[model samples]
Target chain A: MIRALFPVLAILAVWVLLADGALACAVCSGGDDDVKVKDSYVAATIFMSLLPLCVVGGGFLFLRHRYRATPDE
Target chain B: MTSRTTSLRVVTNPRPPVVPSAVLGMLLFLFTELMLFAGLISAHSIARAGALLGWPPPGQPRLPLEETALNTAALLLSGALLIVAQRVFARDKRRTKPWLTASIALGAFFVIFQGVEWVGLIREGLTLTSSTHGGFFYLIIGIHALHAVAALIVLGMNWLRLHRGILAQSTFAAGQVFWYFVVGVWPILYWRVYG
Candidate 1:
């Protein structure tokens, strides 16, 4: 129980630390400190990062399942 | 010593893999490419959101939204045509030729249109070093265009093989996988960059 909890706690701490950086952009012209902009930026970044993974990963998993199901037929 | 006679028989029953190794390899390659695009997109999102004067910035020429929407439709049509070609190829190779040709034509048109659009943008003062907006626009779209060009070459080769009556399913499928990747990635880029 304790060993599993350690990883979860570690992940949570990292997430907290990285939260601020998530709202930052390399090419931004600056001066945008609005709460809405910051929140939307974080959300969009996360969505962009995850969307591709979900698509490609889900496709791979489906293919794997199908491959396993139809063997030597 | 007595002479021994050996008989050889052809084996016709062989087990085939469920998914071709070539297609699987392409999928893995596309996954990595997808990650690269994701990183660029994430940066674009951040830049757009955090900008002081909103996205596209002040004094920059507006992105051609309507023109690109039509281009997007053409690309999607090309994807559909390619699917038809793949399906028909299995049933009749000769019949598949026209579909493949049409698909290639549409895809080439998309690339050509993009080139024209880029020329216009450059003429209008949008370039790599002009601004961050210009930089991201060129970098992201240029990378995608590079992949599209390479995929077109692959598809062209596959078409040549089809003409020679030697287009193997694995080779054709590999070309299709790359084409699909090129097609699949565009809409996201369109929404983010153009829309």
Candidate 2:
């Protein structure tokens, strides 16, 4: 699971990049632009570490909740 | 005293089932979805605040805020109907169809209104590529609409099951959870898109 979700976090890392890098796009513009978005690497690192755990944990809770109750009433 | 027989499918459980598990599942799904959108909205909020340009960009018309507000009303009404449907279904499954149908209708109306408003916004000159405002508006609303679509499918399934027979309360409850998700997501969209 860790191996599989690593890429998603990496991609998110790139998104946070926009928070810091690249000032002007005066010359041209387009989709996904491949522009490095600007953000502190520290913040992105924290997010990458945090979000997937949240996703996995939430799914676990949901599944467990579905089975926890008695079927009747 | 009464005795119970065990079923071969153990996961299905040999004992009588608990209260509606589906309700919790739906609620769980809603919470997960809220987190997902919350992430996006948070990013957008931070980015918008930092933008050299105010949202809506230099020339873009301010959002069709009033139109979107009306759409918000449609979703809120749908939520109410779902609550009513859950109540009726719990007491007597036979008559859930009307409330369920009303909930479904309101759900459909919300989506239709969103689509119309999108078209109007485009006619007024907003496109995903046009500006960051346009980008966030389209992406956020589009994703929320997808959730709404999924919620409708859950409703449809529940509706079908009700017609066929009294579905397990867990299943109906699960459906309600999803319905609430559809309703819960709207206000976040409305505030960011218009406010």
True C-alpha contacts between chains kept, each model in order: 0.51, 0.10
List model 1 lDDT by residue over A1-65, tens digit each: 99979999999999998876442344453436676567767686678767777987898798888
Q: Which predicted model would earn the best lDDT? A: 1
Candidate 2 lDDT by residue in tens digits, B9-92: 445535554334566556656666776786777566545655655666789978877777787888898899889988898798
lDDT of all predictions, in order shown? 0.87, 0.75
Model 2 segments more than 4 A misplaced:
A1-73, B1-31
Residue lDDT tens for model 2, A1-73: 9999999999998889866544342422212222232332234346656766886797688657756753533
DockQ of candidate 1 compared with the true complex: 0.40
- Model 1 TM-score, all chains together: 0.83
Question: Model 2 in CAPRI terms: which quality?
Answer: incorrect
Every candidate's DockQ is 0.40, 0.10
- lDDT by residue for model 1 over B42-116, one digit each (tens)? 778777766677768887888899999999999999999999999999999999999999999999999999999
Name the weakest run of 10 consecutive residues (lDDT summed) in model 2 chain B.
B10-19
Off by over 4 Å in 1: A1-32, A52-57, A68-73, B1-12
